[model samples]
Target: MSICSYLWCLIISLSCVAPLSGNPAAVKEQISLKREKTITNIVNGVPTIDKKFFARINMPYRDKVCGGVVIDRWWVLTAARCVDHVSDHQYELRNVFIEIGNFTTGSQQKKTYKAKAIVIHPMYNLTTNSHDIALIKLVKRAPMFRVAELCSEPVEYGTEVGACGLGSTPARHPSPSASLHEIFLRGIFFSFASFFEIDFCPDDQVCTEPITDGASICNLDEGSPLYKLQCHSRAAECILGIASHFVASEHSEINCSGGSNFASVPHPYEWISETIVFDFLFNSGHLDRSF
Candidate 1:
């Protein structure tokens, strides 16, 4: 279906739902009514038909949610800032859970795994938003889900890519969508992203603009996978980057109007590989720790 038609259908479908007004009673009723149905619009995007490699990083204690990609049987990749609370002692690995193999955020059938460890890039700078990627170690292997392969080369400018996430549509709903949504974006040069107010786009980041009108990344989309299909097969998608942040001038704004930035997967491929391998060998007692 076309983007416009899809959006129209979403509007018609939600027209009957209770409006989330300032009335506490109305808000409570709306919440109660939709507790079992979280599926909503995706800022003009469409619902994803398949979500094999998609993952959701849930921090229930902090009431935070971020998107993730399953990279290995026991590892997932996401934005470092999503789990940065760990550095400040606000939360721990025990509080982080990775949910996979589900399209809806409210689905009770998805597989959940505890985070055994989280490795944030040593060079990650919260202030500058540089090196924003991180690796999460799952306590149990997630072999039932497909693992997304990191792109070996940088995505070319003007290349079309897909971004999937369970984020909010500020215009439609303030809450994250119950269902997964996918949007198509075209990569553009950092020079073209002048509206983002960034003096220069770092090499470690990939910049993309929405291909469809009104489509954009929203709140809770952080760390979501931005991928490209391999051989045009939806099932064979490769990870190109993870949703980093919106670099708009208004840093406080959650609506991504200018464009979105992603931490390039290829830029940190070496670190990711080394971290996974070293962690495996060290845990298996195959590597000597006393150097």
Candidate 2:
């Protein structure tokens, strides 16, 4: 793929942080504070390949909090924390909606369905961030838009992976309704585990960075799925990784947003396939699961 380079504007900071305590764990030696988890106020650089595919995500919060994938006719997969921000009842799954086949700004796509129920990853914990994932249930079966295909084989070192999202561009993020959109950004990473590590799992979570296409996903890029592209394969080239958190914040005195640091997703996505997430979909009846 050709790399598109864009100069990044200064990243505005998000001001919340989770305080960590020096505690001991059953299997750890030295304990450091884990990342305090939170969601961004807006999404930037949101993009989609097909409006129909795009139509499968783009949800409505109290006012469009974020985006996700409609894996099953009944399930929309998104970050567990993203759902939590707009929900008061951690135990209840109701009053959430999503739109697909549409862009953040202008559009042309199809309709999927409204969310009737929502479910977070059973293992996800806001405190430790054990599992940072979730599933949303649509009240009805969303029309079958093509779902992303996860790789059955492991990703090779230096294997090509692609990322797309309704996330913030380096210039604009957490944009309001007027600036909100779904734009696609090709992600390139600075390192790789599959190529670099000998004991890495070949599952879904293989990490890499842009070598030339230097644009990366920002705070709003949570739960954005990374894909590998090939000219021959019709299905997903492979699952690269989810848009997780920035590592620089852990060592730097600042955050990712430029405040002391920036926001990031904790775990990389290795098994967050639409099918894996679809199992938790509350009302999945209309969609096919032959995948």
Candidate 3:
């Protein structure tokens, strides 16, 4: 997760204030979908559709719902934005429960895990989405869920990128239940994403769009992993970016039209792979004394 740089965060927090729901394309269109195995390989370079590539991170807040990528028995990747409020945490990764291996809301395929320690990027700035990545070291390793492999570069300009989450579609009024109704997401071709002037994707992130009219992100799906299609690779998943942004206007009109353009700050996993955090875990004996 990119740390919020003081300047970036301030600007983003202000972007939502002006609000842009008036644009018809920014609105969301609702369609009733029954649980169908998410169709993958529907777009180029994406892996097969046999299994879902995401996991749901349940949190206390309605809009701030977090997401996790199934890495292995002991790890999941999410955004530091989910826990940006932790100024005084010493592994204080709270409200970090993830339900993985499911297709629809309340799927039985879900497995719950507790974050043993959430290591937020040192440079993460919640305000600007700098280093907007985080790792939820699970108390117990997750099973069956395959960890999506991340791409090093911004997927080819017009690539088919996919996002999934037990996240919600916009609801102007809040639902009394905690369950988030997942949105029907597909491989969006980012062919024309500049009209909105939407800009949250930093060099560290990428989900702005050459696809999905207006090119936006969704509520609660924050911290969800982004993947590009890589059919030739045998890897179980093709992860391209991490979800991070705050641009949906929340205006009922936009939410109704079923269009919202947003972006996510991504962590070049190539960079993250060599960080001390990996070494800290390889030597598990250090957390108690290393810091």
Candidate 4:
């Protein structure tokens, strides 16, 4: 196969951390603390390794919260709710930065980009959380970063997909994790017969439960990618959905374990394609001057 074809095939396959040195006593004490297992917010997830291409969406003040996947050299795919901070349904892209390559927040191995523009789906509805996908354009091309390929194949029930993010644990993470974490989720059937069900896992979404009984996405995990491993390639994975919201038992509580709803990429591939094309053209109009 040609280089371009191989690369595109890889694209269709969409697809951490740290410590210090010191005095003997102090070092032993630090190692002891590190070995101690704290309650994780993601339930049963584990930390991801290096070289994976994921996006950590942070606010102007460097507060990393939401998660995203790089889809192009200059564009990232994330949940619309992550960047839609305004309440009046207006387009107000916030001053946010995209952190790439660094699993841990402050690591020098990562690349940072100032978001040049935010594009939320025009038909997104906050009341019901429908059409929940969005794209962010970086100020410049991320040639060194790996980009995920957009996949339109339907996800089958019972397919196990992997999700990664910097979300905190239920006790409320003191701050975002230094490393990106991952969890395996299995596809499930969602019945939209009732109004309540429709409100949570609407027609346009896909429902998934953690492969482990207690695994779940916490407060800061919104917009993370839901992807499947490539059929024969360990290094390649395909993007199937974008984490939008979750559904837990009715209770006045935080960090409850439950299933999550993802904005189905296959269902709205056209919209995504059109939006990306329009944004690229709009932004690239001045490229020739620089070229």
Error of 3 at 153 (Å): 2.8
State which candidate has the highest lDDT.
1
The alpha-carbon deviation from the true structure for residue 158 of candidate 1, after best TM-score superposition, in angstroms, is 0.6
Residues 139-219, model 3: lDDT tens digits: 666664466555544433433445544433334332222332322233222322333333333355453321333223444
Candidate 2 per-residue lDDT, tens place, 74-93, comes to 55566665665545353333
lDDT of each: 0.70, 0.41, 0.46, 0.64
Error of 4 at 85 (Å): 2.1
Off by over 4 Å in 3: 1-51, 61-64, 87-95, 169-200, 210-216, 231-237, 249-267, 275-282, 285-291
Which digits, one per residue and each the tens of the lDDT, describe model 4 over residues 130-219? 888887778788864478876676555455667777765432343456677777776643332122233334556777655565566666
* TM-score of each model, in listed order: 0.75, 0.55, 0.60, 0.71
Per-residue alpha-carbon lDDT of model 1 for 24-105, expressed as tens digits? 3543333233222111113567778576888989898888889999999988999988987764232477789998886865
Judging by TM-score against the true structure, name the best candidate: 1
Per-candidate alpha-carbon RMSD to the true structure: 13.0, 12.1, 13.1, 13.2
- For model 3 the TM-score comes to 0.60
